[model samples]
Target: MKLSQLKILDAIVSSQSLKQAAEKCHKTQPALTMAMQKLEQDIGFTLIDRSGYRLKLTPAGERFYKQAKRVLSGCDELDKISSTLALGYEPSICIAYEQLAGDQRISQLFGNVIQQFPRTQFKIVGGSRFQAVEKLAKGEVDIGIGPWFDIFHASGDFQSVLLKPIDVILVASPKILANGRTTLTSDELDDIPCLTLKPTELPFDDEKLSFAKGSQVVMVEELATLRSLLLQGVGWGLAAKHVCKTELENGDLVQIRLSDDEDQFQSELRAFRSNRNFYGPVASAIWQGLQELY
Candidate 1:
């Protein structure tokens, strides 16, 4: 089907009614219905079940709607790039990273994108990888930097580049450590009240906290809260060294450094995006900057 048809279909999926969808597309109800009919006939499948007062997509229709939206979004990106190129203007890139990775990762990754492409502007935000990827699917953001979360791979909406690896370490409040017990052998961490960042489903070691475990467990809402909770002496959280840099530097936090065993957990910063999304000038600039990082 045509790009306009796909966009109209996507709008119908969102508006949920013929009247609303037609209003959204600035067309009459009959014209909108004809468009839907043409699309369904071309695709050889029923796109929606019109039995309800509010429109709902059939199972096959829901699937088509998703794919169609991505195609339309890609077209929109191409239009934006073509227009910008004609006007001799540098494009903008919006980046979102898992807050768990912290600002250091963004600064190291996209910081130079700003300097290299003087005309382009970069906006960086922090959240969970899931949140970042969700925004990417909606074509709201250009690139995402974070760990390679398994769920994103499962969904097929993400492409990733692995950066540096790290361990998920359990960090205790210095208040508890002040009893001189902060110096625990690696074995003692098993029984500690660790603030886990991972969800209960990942294939993680039960006995050994990947120290990086909590990054996977942390939800969008809980990501920022974990850092504050650690500061409050609530419990130990498993996070990257960069994530807690300020606290560690200020002596408010410390890693449970293991002397006998080398930390082997391999969490890494990964750059990602949806398949249909375009990596225009702004995105390329960020990639260029990240390439120069140590």
Candidate 2:
């Protein structure tokens, strides 16, 4: 019934033995046993199955513990929120980014933010293509860092700071190249399976500067999967140069060229946020820091 009793139960379930649980809870085995006994008496049911060598939760206890865990998690979040509010910062600020965002830069920015505001919780969500921008538009995230397109800027509801420009190039395994030719005609390109990011809220148009616009596309949600497929000669697709830098250098993957530079395009990576949301201290610090760091 008491939160302390629930804590004891949690420790017992997590630890290898009752003695280990006692150490984890910072209480003697007898004390922990007495607490659980009192808890069972209050609820009029046995919570632990003691007949077995290893302790196991009874059917009723399993159900009760599931609900109790939720309460404990809620309490933890409530404490974090209270502490964050007391420090005059947002409870949490989430950064949604695509694979194109350089890992080194993102890590450096994240580390700086942690050092500046240790009390604020930071969440990082990874998406592909325009999914980060879509999350920003829906207000699901406090910030988005990914490829920038004029269509995204045309909305005028978001503000962005440009980061590095990424070169998205069409690549495939060398095994698939017949006669060692890197260039593929439009008809030939369409004949090959093209790994691409799944469509987001943004409209799809062949007229837009997209690599897989006119290909036999195989949509994937993650960049790693797409890269794996390309490595296995499963398909050809466009990917950021950095994402496959090692592959290209090692000759595991070869860039497939198209006429009129349609095989590659420069995508500007930008950190953007909605203007509608009021910026808290933590969010403002992150926004400003990204601009300075990138």
Candidate 3:
């Protein structure tokens, strides 16, 4: 029933003699004979029959020999796989982050880690800050990337590492602008409503050049809906510059600065997960990579 017995059976079958099989297996003939007998008893079958000086395989014995060969071959394959893992330099790591940071920040971090560990694998996920952070908390994601103003204020619930500075841009359509992509004072934005995907309120320093309360801010949390509203030229919004790179490059959208804005950069990229088992190979690999990006 054991793999050892199966291998002996296979060797005996190929050698066609107990003496040769015993020598091939580095065991005495009597040991090989008893092993075969125990194997047949365990399987409830007759595996071999003695004939004068040679051996003949019974129906069950022939079947067992065929299976034994396969089993031995499989064992050999498993050993090879284990040995390769131990010897190879490559390792795999998984990560989750915003789509905006996937090709940019995430890759930048990966580049730093890969220089030291060239044969490492990283599984990347692209999602919003909310979705990515939730995954990290649930142990579904190794790292979360997003603006974590809420998480930072939550305090002591998790750990975070901050990267480069970030500032949400004021994106507007050409139709809404007379000067078109130039800077504007806050008074100019007072009459203009902003498009958003969700109902949320966050503060920004607008006293430098403009001051206003309650612009027609449209709520849109979904990317598709947000993009659609953005294309409509209905209002202006505070968004990550990287998120609209394609639109900006294609002349579909332009950034209008609030005049004399001193608090231009108010955000930073952060990576985090809930406190748990964080020292696994995956974590070590990604943290090493993401730190460079930061």
Better of 1 and 2 by TM-score: 2
Number of the top-ranking candidate, with TM-score as the measure: 2
Q: Which ten-residue region of model 3 has the weakest summed lDDT?
A: 200-209
Cα TM-score per model: 0.65, 0.67, 0.51
Candidate 2 off by > 4 Å:
1-87, 154-156, 203-210
- The residue-by-residue lDDT of candidate 2 on 61-122, one tens digit each, is 99998898768766755665576568688767889978778668668878888888877778
In model 3, how large is the Cα lDDT of residue 91?
Answer: 50
Winning candidate number (lDDT): 2
- Between the candidate structures 1 and 2, which one is better when assessed by lDDT? 2
Point out where model 3 deviates above 4 Å.
1-94, 104-125, 137-140, 150-156, 179-187, 199-212, 259-263
Relative to the true structure, how large is the alpha-carbon lDDT of every model? 0.67, 0.81, 0.66
C-alpha RMSD (angstroms) for model 1:
5.9
Taking the tens digit of each residue's C-alpha lDDT, what string does model 1 give over 126-224? 665256656665567878776665656654467677666655665767875646565566555545556554343223313343353322233324666
With a 3 Å backbone cut-off (N, CA, C), the pairs that clash in candidate 1 are 168-211, 168-212, 169-211, 197-214, 197-217, 198-213, 198-214, 198-216, 198-217, 199-217
lDDT-based ranking, best first? 2, 1, 3
Candidate with the larger lDDT of 2 and 3 = 2
Candidate 1 segments whose C-alpha is farther than 4 A from its true place = 14-45, 50-55, 88-90, 101-112, 115-121, 149-162, 174-222, 246-251, 254-264, 273-280
Over the full model, what C-alpha lDDT does candidate 1 score relative to the true structure? 0.67
